[model samples]
Target chain A: AQSVTQPDARVTVSEGASLQLRCKYSYSGTPYLFWYVQYPRQGLQLLLKYYSGDPVVQGVNGFEAEFSKSNSSFHLRKASVHWSDSAVYFCVLSALTNSAGNKLTFGIGTRVLVRP
Target chain B: GPKVLQIPSHQIIDMGQMVTLNCDPVSNHLYFYWYKQILGQQMEFLVNFYNGKVMEKSKLFKDQFSVERPDGSYFTLKIQPTALEDSAVYFCASSLYGGTYAEQFFGPGTRLTVL
Candidate 1:
């Protein structure tokens, strides 16, 4: 079984400030990680995904995440956030096996508020 | 980017009644999925369908829950004798393939309120 943990339930950052959201996963084997964001009344949109190779992956809207194998973490970061960046972000985990069928296990999600 | 569409953005139904949630996935996608999210909780996977069969289902998929995509039409999730606990936002997602790297596009979600 795979699971994800987002320690921060909420985060408040001023617009144009740097933002980082922490995510940790519990999985023994190599895992495929993803960051998804949900705007108000909208469906989740993919921020980025990590499978292998480079630890740092860039996503849309100037968002990026670094995958740390030793720390078992994949944290999302943005150098500058806009007011529209206020949304709920989820960290998801998927096992490498086909038997799991790529079903995603999600964290409790971190709600970010970008104050102007 | 491809888009998935879900019908009935919001639905209100009485407990013990039957309800069906509809999803129209990306035109060429081969896999469809359903997930549930209660108020202030993480979204959990319910089931995945492909090739006219259920590929995977989580324990959260209750016995009363059923899914089907007839003749490549809308992928539907039907629940019989709905309970209050079943009241939640159901999201429909679809992917071009079923694998580790497939990206699943999601619909805006259907919010079901059972009273």
Candidate 2:
């Protein structure tokens, strides 16, 4: 079984400041990782995804995440955040199951508040 | 980017009643999925459907729950004799394929309130 953990339940950052959200996963095999953001009252939008290749993957809106196999972590970061960036971010893990399709396990989500 | 649409952003039903949540996946997507999230909790996968059959379901998918996509129409999740515990936001998602790396696009989610 695969699981995801987001240690930070909430994060507060001033607008134009750097932001980072921590994520950890528990999976023995190769893991597919994803970062998604949910704006107020909106559906989740993919920030980025990482399966292989470069450890650092850039996402939309200047967001990027680095995968660390040694640390079992995939943390999201943004150099400068806008007020609109305030949203709930989720770290998800996907792995092949015994069934036909893959199932996604989500972290508890970290709610970010970008204060101006 | 493709978009998935979920019908009735919010639904209120009485306990023991039946509720059906509808989802219109991406036009060319081949896989559909349903996930549930209670208030202040992580989203949990409920089931996935492909080729008009349920490909997989999690333990959270209760016996009272059922899913279908008839003639490529709306993918529906029907829960019979709904309990208070079934009250939660149900999100519908679709992907072009079914694999470890397939990206699933999600709908805004249908909030079901069982009283």
Candidate 3:
């Protein structure tokens, strides 16, 4: 019953605006959390991943994510978003379970639209 | 950045026909995997392969599906008598190893269309 939930189906932000996408995961044990972005017709690109250590991890393209075990959440954030950042973002979860081999359980995804 | 490559990018096949999706994983990686994503749905795990063996597979991996990588070549996912429900974008990923310690890199994916 491991699953990821992205409550926001779509998020819109103006260029140069700060953005935050919410993600919640349900797992009994500590989880490896990741954020991935997919452009149209392209494969997913990993933004960041959190296995342990610092609660906040920085990723490529000025993206960052914070993992909270208490809340079972790993939310993605950006200080400022560009039009190029508009894409579908997925929150993925992995653990040492039968369901998680190289396989990841992904959220439904949140489509970000950067408006000018 | 590591790169995984998938072949064809797109494919169209009739129902009940067999289709094989090819994936070229990153060199020196020991773990390979396949995932399926329908439009507007979350990408789901299909199976994982390591050391030329099927390590684990989800329910989505029907019996009609099989995976192999001969002599460390392309990792192939073959589905026999594909059904319309089988039509989806298939993503191939590879990691240096399996389990929880490795990071998986993904390919561009192959869009399989079953008509």
Candidate 4:
């Protein structure tokens, strides 16, 4: 079955420091990957998505992700962390399990906390 | 940017009761979807609707569950005889199209609590 795994349940980083969140996926075919962030009491926001082209894709808020089919991973990274960046990040795999254009399978989610 | 809006941010109901969750999708969106997120668990897809009909649904979308967009209005997910397990955040999403090249817009989600 197709699935997404965010191994890190929680991460702590100092403001202004760099950050990286790990994600691994299991799928049989070419995968469409996405990163999403959710602030408290807010809806899930798209960060970036990897469809096919370049191995590295840039998202909003200076966030970027590298997709590696060999490793079956699409990890999210940021050059500088901000307190506002502290949120729950989810890695999703887009599969056409249904007719839904976005039949997404999400990871458990990694919660990031930025410390001042 | 386009946005999806879910009605009744919160709802408390007794088990076995019927409930409807409403979603106002992007004005021009053609595909609509519903997902369930249990606390501390990953969000799971429920069903997707288009042209007033259900195009696809996951196993989690039980037989008691139904989705429709009546007269090109709000897309709605109705659960007949709700179960306690149905207590979760139901997120409504829509995209101009389904498949690659379409970015899905999501709502804030409606929290459903069952007693």
Candidate with top TM-score is 2
Clashes of each: 0, 0, 0, 1
Best-fitting candidate, measured by DockQ? Answer: 2
Worst 10 residues of 2 chain B by lDDT: B95-104
Flag regions of model 1 displaced more than 4 Å. Answer: A97-101
Give a tens-digit lDDT track for model 1, residues A1-116. 78899999999999999999999999998889999999988788999999999999999999999999999999999999999999999999976645534688899999999999
Model 2 Cα lDDT, one tens digit per residue, A56-82: 999999999999999999999999999
Instruction: Write down the worst ten-residue block by lDDT for model 3 chain B.
Output: B95-104
Clashing pairs in 1: none
Q: Candidate 4 overall Cα lDDT vs. reference?
A: 0.91
lDDT of 1 by residue, B1-115 (tens): 6788899999999999999999999999888999999998889999988889998888989999999999999999999989999999999999887787788889999999999
How do these models rank on lDDT, best leading? 2, 1, 3, 4
Error of 1 at A40 (Å): 1.2
Give per-residue lDDT, candidate 2, residue A115.
97
* DockQ of the two-chain complex in candidate 2: 0.78
Clashing pairs in 3: none
True lDDT of residue B35, candidate 2: 99
Looking at candidate 2, what TM-score does chain B attain?
A: 0.98
Backbone-clash count (model 4): 1
